[model samples]
Target: MIQKLRQSGTLLGFVLILLFFALKLPDTFLTARNLINISQQLSMLAVVAATMTIVMVMNDFDLSVGSMASLSGIVAAMIFTAGYPVWVGLSAGLLVGVLGGLFNGFLVSVVGILPFVATLGTLTVFSGMAFLLSDGKTIFGRDIPTSFSGFARSGIEIGDIKIPMLTITAGLVIFICWCILEHTNFGRRLYAIGGNKEASHLAGIKVVRLRLIAFSLTGLGAAGAGLMYAARVASANPTQGSGLMLDAIAAVFLGMTMSRRGEPKVIYTLVGVLILGVLDNGMTQLRVDSYVREILVGLIVLAAVSVSSLSKRRQS
Candidate 1:
């Protein structure tokens, strides 16, 4: 019973947040259209959070996600601006993500550098690359192909609500990640490694290979999010994804609080994403200042991590 309540507490908090907003802005927040709008807005963050969960599950971190995303979008947008096919640009962006992730993994698993230091260095490198690729300007207007920009804008309509393609794509990515983390042998190995890396290595688990793969997936997700963001706005800026890494990490940490083992889960991460999304939307409607919103979110993240640590101590 205690465990159940603990697990449900985050969900309850989410419900309370929703109810609070609904009561305060009954004409807007409680409406289905507004709820769907929130989902659409959070779609890109959700994609990043999905893979971030996997990275955290392995007890690893990827601070370079935001920079990698910016680089990917710049790469794709530049290609489109130069009159290349959409597929060509997309392939180049994804390749950058994969190769970038591999570089981070290589530094951590092969060169014995810590994940934090390696990713921080790479984050700076990738951010610089993004500016270099885009010449420190936003790519917009007729330079971006209509076909490419239409990808995120197109969607299925159900009555009054139109489900965005970006949201659907995010959902699919989240489902795939959930399956990989919850139902696959690879996932089991990750948990084993996280629980005890030395024992996992003794048990013949390829720790280095798994870590590389985990980081690769994270990069891929970040790249995909970048592409979607670029598509949604029909433009790509060097700093467009500069804030994604912090938000994604915060969502993962918040979700970890809901886990019985204090580990990250994709579904819970989605809930965390929703909580942040709703908070942003609600506060915006209530005319809260942006700086105040940031401070509140930071406080919430700190509280969530403290709660998670306290729960793990109790279990131990």
Candidate 2:
């Protein structure tokens, strides 16, 4: 009973929070349109959080995710500005993410730097690089091809229902991450490494290679988010992705506590992301102080981390 309750707590809270908001603002909060918008808003965070799970599984942080997203957006925007095909620009952005992750991998796996320190350095570098690319200005959507912007906003639409590209992208990434984590040897090795690095190494696991791949996926995921953001707003700014880093990381930890073993899982992370999105929408309707979002998110992170640590200690 205790285990079941514990596992379901986060999800239960999710539903209750929605109910509270719906009760408080019947017309605004309970509307299907509002709910869909909230989901769309958190889609980018979901993508980043999905990959963040992989990094956490190997016991690492990708602080550079925010900047990585910014860099990816800048890359795509610049390509469009130069009149290149939007596909080319997007592909370039994804490649940049991979390269950035590989570099981080080299630093940690080859140069033996701590994951936090390595990603922090890259975060600063990527942030600066983004500004340098755009001259610290927003790359306006009007400057990009109409087709690009249109496709960004285009998705399946059926009468009163619409599914956004960003949502689809996030779903695809989450599905892929879940498959890789749950069904592959690579995923099993990640769990083994996170559970016991020395033992995995002793057992002949290529801990370095596997971890490098994990970090690389973080970069790729961040890039996907950046592209979505840039497309949605039809603009790219160096600072666009900064605030999302903590949120994505927070959701990843939140997800860890949703499982019996405190393992990082994608579905739980989506729930965490949805919690944030719903809170933001609900609070906005209530005219709450914008700062409250930060406070509540901080509290959520703190609680999630504490729960995860406790779960791990009990399991041990």
Candidate 3:
């Protein structure tokens, strides 16, 4: 029973949080409309968190994800404002993210730089590039096509529930990430490498190549998220994804609690994202101050890390 609780604590916490909010905000929290709104708001974060799981499973981190996301969005927005096709802008944004990911992977895997340091440096570089691209301004207004802006605003209806397209898009991305990490041989090798890098290398795993791919995936996820945000709001800004890095990290750490071995997993990360989403949405409904909300979130993250640490210690 104790072991089971340890493994399922995050899910339990999520349920309890739901109950608390439902009771406190009886008039608003349980409404189908508000529930859908929460899903829409968290969709982008979920995608980033899901991909972050892949990077974390290989015992690597990508601090530049947020900055890469911001830059990617700006790249797409600039192209859009330049009267380019929507697909062209989207592709350019995605390409920027991929290239940035490759650069980070090369620095860490080939140049032997630490993951933290490499991504951190790239974070600054990407953020600067975003600012340069937009001249530190937001991209919006008449220049953005209805098709592009409509991307975020569109959705499908199911009986009484309206599901935003963003939610569906995020779901597809999460599902794909889950399949890659849970079903593929590549994912198995990543876990092996994370477990013991030297041993995996001795066992003939191409550690560097795999790591490069993982980081690139991370970049791709971040960029995908950025584009979603831009489409939803019908605008892009240099600082749009500034907070994504910490939020994604927190979500992943919260998710590690769901793993018996305290390793990150895609499904667990989605749960973590949901938890963060719940907390944010609940607090907002209660009119909680933004700074206080940040403080509480930080504490929750610290607690999650502590739980994961304890789990790893017991395993060892």
**Hey, what RMSD does candidate 2 come out at?**
1.8
lDDT of 1: 0.88
The whole-model lDDT of each prediction reads 0.88, 0.86, 0.90
Best by lDDT: 3
TM-score, candidate number 3: 0.96
Off by over 4 Å in 3: 311-316
Ranking under lDDT, best-scoring first?
Answer: 3, 1, 2
* lDDT, candidate 3, 1-316, per-residue tens: 5556667766887898899999999999989999889999999899889988888998999999998889999999999889899999999999998899889889999999999999999999999999998999998998778898898999999997889999999999999999999899999999998899899999999999999999999999999999998888889999999888889999998998888777889999998999899899999999999999989888877776676566556655
Q: Score candidate 1 by TM-score against the native.
A: 0.96
What lDDT score goes with residue 210 in model 3?
95
**TM-score of each candidate structure, all chains considered together:** 0.96, 0.94, 0.96
Across residues 271-305, which tens digit of lDDT does each residue of candidate 1 receive?
A: 99988999999999999999999898788778767
